[model samples]
Target: MVVPEPGLPAAVTIYEVGPRDGLQNEQGIIPTATKAAFVRRLLAAGLPIVEATSFVHPRWVPQLADAADLMTALRAELGDAAAELPVLVPNERGLDRAVELGLRHVAVFASATDTFAERNLNRTVDSQFEMFAPTVDRALAQGMDVRGYVSMCFGDPWEGAVPIDQVVAVGTRLLDLGVGQLSLGDTIGVATAGHVRALVAAFAAAGIGPERLALHFHDTYGQALTNVHAGLQAGVTTYDASAGGLGGCPYAHSATGNLATEDLVWFLTGLGIEHGVDLTAVAATSRWMAAELGRPSPSAVVRALTPPTE
Candidate 1:
């Protein structure tokens, strides 16, 4: 039932964020070995860029406390390929650890609203950039590719509706600070398809084209896939999704798991778009991981495609 959509990109890059963002807020500490295995499974399933883990402090995200250990295991398991995995480096200390490990790709988290910035980063919206500037500069000097994540792009729990111009301002500052790409986060999944188009248009108007942007949507309100369709129509070719729909904002309790990678694959497959992911394999991997986590996958595609038990 493949149908080609007019004006959509023939190919899209699925930036897999399951390992880091997906597991960051989990209740239990997934063993480093299990985390490594999960990442390996996703890569084997044809995920192009699997974000492996975060270098953020263990206190803030206890689930990924073994970030270094996971990276070490991945390096031993995947060798040179492990260097291509992306990790979140929240500050200079995190960057130092990443540099020490010879990691090549890193991402920084930021918030569009001042309230969220203070809650998440303990800094105001403007000051978060000051903190990220040095980290971005150092990472770039060390030959690392940096991706900036602007959360609360659509709306905020504390601040309610966020202005489009405010989102643009935060995103542009990250770009100005030398981030190679921007991942606009609908952190609480409150965005509609129209909001998606308007935000993309706003970014484009600010001279940041779709080529330099990626959409990261949460499925809290069940609008994730809808927003993705609008992103595609607006010429966005990169998306951030989690396998098995496993992730939520730790700072924002209302935010649910991300748009599932399996669901994204299904939607893209139906549209005859090229993402190079094996839908069956991803579903299988998610099923396995869900068993390990002692929960059912929240992804509709995974639930529909996978057997009741494996």
Candidate 2:
């Protein structure tokens, strides 16, 4: 079943986000030790780039209240590899924490629509960059590469269909602010495959090729995998996925868990695309994490291959 695809890139970089984005929205707090183990398992399974944790204020995401502690544990366990892990830094304060930990890679969250910006960031869409500007500057000053996440690129629950132009506008502003890459987010998962291609095309027209972009999709409406296919055809080589499908927007109630890493690996493997992830190991890890959370994994590949135990 290893069929090679014609148009897709030979290799893709799976930006694993489970440790950070996946656990942030959990109702119960996961221990720092458990979180560190999750990252270690992922790295052992051949995930090239795993996002470690977020530095946002604990008041906002209590589940990741131990961000600093988790990073410390990861450093002790993984050593130099820990610094290669990416962390989400919401603003200057978060970036400061990352700097103190000697972390080198970081990401900042941005919103495409005004409503989501107000709710998630407490600033207007245009003004949100003002908040990110200094943080991006300081991170760059310290020789860190910052990835920008543009949420609600496809559709917003409050604003309905987001215009392609508006999404590009917000994305380019982040690029202007010096983010090395931008991850387009389908936050509520309302996008269709056609919409996904259109948005990617729009960015391409703006001189933002797939080389500078990553796709982040949710499975709220079950369009996540389909959109990934579109991204592949459109030449996107980087994707953001969660393990066990374990993530949703803490701010957007309508949003659901992200596209599962196991599922993405299965898809890539079937197409003969050289994604460096080990699918069997990822599924096993997801099952282990699901056991810790006392739930079944939502990934179709994980569920089909590793049946739930009694």
Assess candidate 2 and give its TM-score to the true structure.
Answer: 0.98
CA error at residue 141 for candidate 1, angstroms? 0.4
Q: Candidate 1, overall lDDT?
A: 0.95
TM-scores for candidates 1 onward, in order: 0.99, 0.98
Per-residue accuracy of model 1 over 1-310 as CA lDDT, tens digit each: 9999999999999999999989999998889999999999999999999999998888888998899999988999999889999999999999998998889999999999999999889999999988999999999999999999999999999989999999999999999999999999999999999999999999999999999999999999899999999999999999999999999999999889999999999999999999999999999999999999999999999999976555
True lDDT of residue 176, candidate 1: 95
Provide the overall lDDT of each model, using Cα atoms, as 2-decimal numbers.
Answer: 0.95, 0.93
Residue 229 displacement in candidate 1 (angstroms)? 0.5
Model 2 error, position 290 (Å): 0.3
* Model 1: how far residue 263 lies from native, Å: 0.3
List pairs with backbone clashes in candidate 2: none
User: TM-score: which candidate is best?
Assistant: 1
Off by over 4 Å in 1: 308-310
Candidate 1 TM-score over all chains jointly? 0.99
**Top lDDT prediction, candidate number:** 1
